[model samples]
Target: MDTGKKVGDLFGRLGKVPGRGVGIGLQLLVGAGGLAYGVSQSMYTVEGGHRAIIFSRLGGVQNEVYAEGLHFRIPWFHYPIIYDIRSRPRSISSPTGSKDLQMVNISLRVLARPDAVALPRIYRQLGTDYDERVLPSICNEVLKSVVAKFNASQLITQRSQVSLLVRKELTERARDFNIILDDVAITELSFGKEYTAAVESKQVAQQEAQRAQFLVEKAKQERQQKIVQAEGEAQAALLLGDAVTKNPGYLKLRKIRAAQSIARTIAQSNNRAYLDANTLMLNLTDLGYDQGATRAGTSKK
Candidate 1:
């Protein structure tokens, strides 16, 4: 019984010591946690649409790029730089001058991606924020240079060509920085107020000029119509004069026909009408062709 109590006391005293089994256990726990942390750091995952590049403390950036999947690296000697290799959208805007010295505001939309194969070079030179570093600079450069080659009117008229030129130049330029442009476009464009007003005024003036030309043509056509009418009236008068001179009885015949038409009109009227020698229409009856006797009134026998 004394031996058992003494052994129990000894164990209790050892447990109360400043550092022994407890210190060793704490040290072992710390070592295990550090080892677990290092292993976790050594293994990384590259998700879909992402790429990775390695930087070695001793050897510098590796020339090879890592693709999506599980990848391994030396925990302390190497660091991984991950990049989004997917096409992403970015825009740039600038106020620039045209070839005609007109102020123009333009915006460009770029669909860009880091060249998958050039990821190593990109990390070596440009680092992770490659798009931020290169896109705006190249967009502005291309926009300004392309805009300067066109007049304000041409810029509006040849907008498609301008966009094409910008895309070509910007693509070539961004390529140098290990950036690939999936697509490029000039999304917005506007001219200065003064230039816009001038364009509108010029269009209005052209319309007015066209209207004036139309009016002049209309007047010419009307004048031609009047000249043709006058010629026809003169020719008809000449024909009548020659007929009267050639046959003296023609005037008498014409007069007789006019009297007949007037008499018929009066006869057909609904109102009662009376006639005397002066008031009655002359030569209305079908009188014979002897002038003296016809002038003498003849009733139908």
Candidate 2:
């Protein structure tokens, strides 16, 4: 019985040893809280579509631009400032018009992407407010400067060219801001009321001139048709005259047919011969000559 009791005591002490060790280990871990937190701060994640810059009191730290995914740094000595590396667009409305100075309304759409390789230089020089500071300043400066070169009418008409100029100038200036300008476009352009009205009137006049030209062409076509018809009739008459010369009997036959047609029209009832008074007198003279010749021949016998 005593031996069993001793064995139980030994096992109890052995269990206590593990508990004491675990307690000491926990206490040591608790005491190093600051160190653990510092270590944790050294590691972070730069999510997709974002790039991080490590900033320190030391000017222009060599290591910069943490790409997407987990990254590590020295705790408390370095901090990461994240910037969206995705493409983004910014726009502004045009300045209103003035009397002494005519103004044109212009709206611009600009595409920009962060310079991933130049993040350290950008954060050092341009700082965190890249959109508010760098983008707007470049856009406004380039827009106003390029716009000053053209009149209001020309600005509205040649907006595409103006946009190209803005893109070129801004692209050149963007090197300093550590951004790449992908595209720049002037999406909208407008003019004052009077200028719009004048343009409308000019369009109306152009349409009217086109309509008048169409009418003139139609009249010329009608005149040409009349001339062609007259020429065809003359050609037909010449052909008919040649046929009559080849067959002289055609005229006699035509005269007899004309007289017969007139007779047929007057004698509407068929099988009835209608003779004029001159034809009756010529038949009676031929009958009187035949009677005289017969009576003289009998007397001579």
Candidate number with greatest lDDT: 1
C-alpha lDDT values of all predictions: 0.86, 0.76
Residue-level lDDT tens digits of model 1 in 212-271: 999999999999999999999999999977766565466668767777786798899998
The most accurate candidate by TM-score is 1
* Candidate 2, 195-218: lDDT as tens digits: 778779999999999999999999
104: Cα error in model 1, Å: 1.7
For all predicted structures, in order, the TM-scores are: 0.70, 0.60
For all candidates, what are the clash counts?
0, 0
After TM-score superposition, the amount by which residue 295's alpha carbon in candidate 1 deviates from its true location, in angstroms, is 10
